[model samples]
Target: MVVLATKCYVEGDARSRALDGMGSMLDDDLGELSVEWTVGVRDDDFVSVTVEGEDATVARNLLRERWGEIPTDGRLTAGETYTGTLESWDDEGFVLDAGTRVRVPTSELGLGPGSPSQIRDRFGLVQHLPLRFVAGDADEPARLADAERDRLYEWSRGAGRVNVNSATRGEVRATVNRAGHAGDIVTVERLGLLEQSIVCAEGTDPPGLLASIGGYLPAELKCVIP
Candidate 1:
């Protein structure tokens, strides 16, 4: 059994679809391997897969390659690098979920000059967006990876869309309808079970669209503008 670094927080029919999708993804990742697996969600939205079959070992390795491995032991060792989903943030730092909770201090965020929330918006970092971080020495805080920084830099320069979390794809679409901004989005990209990226239509401003629907969904929403 490997606890996946990703999450699945959607509910109802959306949740059913997400699980079925996850199963298909795992099957594709394993290719021709003869494997039987079950997808399960643990507390706080942790997704795990238990595989059994002739090619289980190879299948497990493939899973690790696609989605960073979850530490079954539940601890991030000093100096090790790992990927996790952003859970929440405070004045001090952001907390990530990787089987166990890991904290990424503001100083370790690598984003500059703002409150944690401000920094998140500046970079369009949405909850459940996978990010890599390295654990620090005894006195230092865990720091964000250069790769994560690069990804954020790219998002900042390339488009106009809001990245959001804690809402299923279906829920996002419904909210957009209620907000009367159905035409503003070109598409919705699923980042995780409950995290999604709204690709804005060519002339639509992502921030403006976010403002239109932000109040309806109680979740973190950040924008990417071209």
Candidate 2:
């Protein structure tokens, strides 16, 4: 997947416009299309859409016609880089990376991190950690180490102790014993490359609780055992 930073005139409407433009292009050029929308963390008003297709040409054309534009800083070239810029009331647009451009809405720059590429990089570092699994009800308690344990305790003091084990084939097999819950099987896997899935008797949420674990672990440390 390719990530491009771009600016636009309508900070709140840009995502919809871009998606609409892409849909139009796809309908006219390609037979059918599929698109997925994801919410942005920085602002509830902003959304990001991921489009996939069998024809690369269609996708390229859609991006070019709708969201493609050089930044005001003149730092981008058509073939060299992709830049996102936002338009101003004066009819001029501001480059996302440009410091002096005020007409450009700061939110329109879309240069902030958390792009798929950035998330992928972050996940790469996290995948090396030893997988820990816990099973049972939400009230069940789990033990953690260092900042991870501390963070979990802070979120919910009742999180049961984790059973550490190696991950294989996208499953984490470990032994866990919680105060009120029985020892049960647990599996942890990638929801995407960037997020993880926790499966147990009780419902599972993404292991955002493990963010601290990632922070404390070395890049070379293997979080998953062979």
Number of the predicted model whose lDDT against the real structure is largest: 1
Provide the global lDDT of candidate 2 against the true structure. Answer: 0.29
Once superposed on the true structure, which residue ranges of model 2 sit more than 4 Å away at CA? 1-22, 32-49, 56-66, 69-81, 87-226
Best candidate according to TM-score:
1
lDDT of 2 by residue, 1-226 (tens): 2222222122345345434543443355434534332222122111233345465555545544443322334342212323222212222212222212222322322323354334223223222122111111234322212433233233233222222212221223221122112233254443211123333333322243233233432222112110
RMSD of each: 3.0, 19.2
Clashes in each model (backbone N, CA, C under 3 Å)? 2, 21
Off by over 4 Å in 1: 167-187, 211-220
lDDT by residue for model 1 (67-166), tens: 7877988777888888899889999899987777788888888867888988887778887887888877678788898887777777666657798887
Residue-level lDDT for 96 in candidate 1: 85
TM-score of 1: 0.82
TM for candidate 2 is 0.22
Q: Which ten-residue region of model 1 has the weakest summed lDDT?
A: 150-159
**How well does each candidate superpose onto the true structure, as a TM-score?**
0.82, 0.22
